[model samples]
Target: MGAFGRNHARVYQQLQQAGSVRLVGVVDPDTARADAIAREFGCKSFGSVEQMLTTHSEVQAASVAVPTVLHREVARALMEAGVDVLIEKPVAATLGEADELLRVALEHKRVAQVGHLERFNPAVRATLPLINRPMFFEVHRLSVFSPRALDVDVVLDLMIHDLDVVLTFVKSEVKEIRAVGLPILSGKVDIANVRIEFESGCVANFTASRVSTERVRKLRFFQAGQYISVDYARQDVLVCSVGSAVGAAHSFATDANEWGTRPSVNPQIQMAKPPITAEEPLLAEIKAFLRSVRDRSRPAVSLEDGRKALELGLAILAEIGRHAGRIAVGKG
Candidate 1:
């Protein structure tokens, strides 16, 4: 099992201890790794999905944390075998692969979820109620370089998380995109900056870097007369509003004393921190997946939602490619 696969197993084991679900098994091509994680989680391990299915014929659902290219293959097999699946992000390597996965899920009537983990973050959940005609957004997700997740560009590996969140917040179709990226530490793009304009006149700027010295995960947006800041790592939201904007967010201002408030340097501006119920995002995401599986309901982050994010991510990559071409031409 890889890093994220082990995390899924751990969370499943935690759920099992609480009597929510059973930890059926873990699968990895590397038998030793699979066996290790299985032992750590107190479950069985198999070298492949087929081996696991052969032993646990009644497996109801599975988390496909395999590489992006193998996502469709593994997930298709599970759905065909009557097992719901939660596929990790960038749903698939290409849109064609994503479409095929979607078709298979529809045909099998499987409850497929995507691992857009940020959607379930306490801060993001807490900020949903505060959305009011968001017009502009600034997001940054930086990480220290690691060999992990180098198969994809930083846009897909890191920025896609913000893409999904912003898409959810804006709820509008993208109208245009401008992007630039570079390969610093990896053959693929290690850092990227993108600006997107939505059909509803909303604009979002995103910066993602896997070569950063310090880690930062934050998103700030401005609506009509209010500015909202979300610290994803800290699971906190800060809102600054004026006049009518403050009135609209009054319900969330009750805990200003507890959450600490910023003194209004400007007589017209007031700042407050929305009450956030901190819960491990992965736990919430997996719980939601199970609930969808049990109730045969829609997942919190459906495959379609994941596809939308991927579509935008791919478009940004395209823009980046074009920008790089222009630079090369100028150099020539």
Candidate 2:
């Protein structure tokens, strides 16, 4: 099992221990790792999806944590065989591949979900009711150098999380995009900065880097008079507002006694952190997937949502390419 695949297995085991679902089996080309995970989780391991399916014909749901290129092929096979799927992010390598996946899921009438794990973060969940009319956003996701997920650029590997969240919050069509990216340790883009304008007059700036020395995952946004911040790693949210802006839009209830009060420079400005119930995001995502599969209902993060994020990521990549071309031409 790879990085995320192992995580999926661990969460499934947790779910199993909680009496929510059964850990049917695991599949990996590397049978040793598969067997090790299976033993640790108290489940069976198979060398391939076909082998797993053949062994457990009653398998109803599965998670596709394979490479981006193999997503379509593996998911298509599973869906066609009457298995619901929760595929990892960047749905497919290309938009056409994403479309094919959409068709397959619809045609098979299978409940398909994309694994945009950050959507389940408690901070994101806590920020939902506070959103009034978000006008501006500043987001950053940086990670120390890693050799993982190098098949795609930083935009897809990392920034797409913010793209999906921002898109969900704005609920507006993207009007313009300006982006620049560069390669570092990997052959693909390792760092990128992007500016996006939505038709609703909202603007967002995103910076993602896989070559950073330290790790940071944070998003800050402003509405009319309120500013909100989310810390993905800490699963925390802080809301700051001035004068009548406090609780003007939403009835944000916070127990100041437990959270404590911190005085601001301006007496009129108030700051508070809304209550957050911290839970492992991966655990929540798997629980949601199991719920969808059990109820035979739509997924929280559908394949269409995944495709939209991928579309935006690809557009950013295209812009980066064009920007690089201009630099090359100038040098010539």
TM-score of each: 0.93, 0.93
Q: Model 1: which residue pairs collide?
A: none
Give the per-residue lDDT of model 1 (tens digit) for 148-256. 8888899988899999999999999999999999999899999999999999988999999999999999999998668999999999999988776344443234455
> What's model 2's overall lDDT?
0.92
Error of 2 at 180 (Å): 0.5
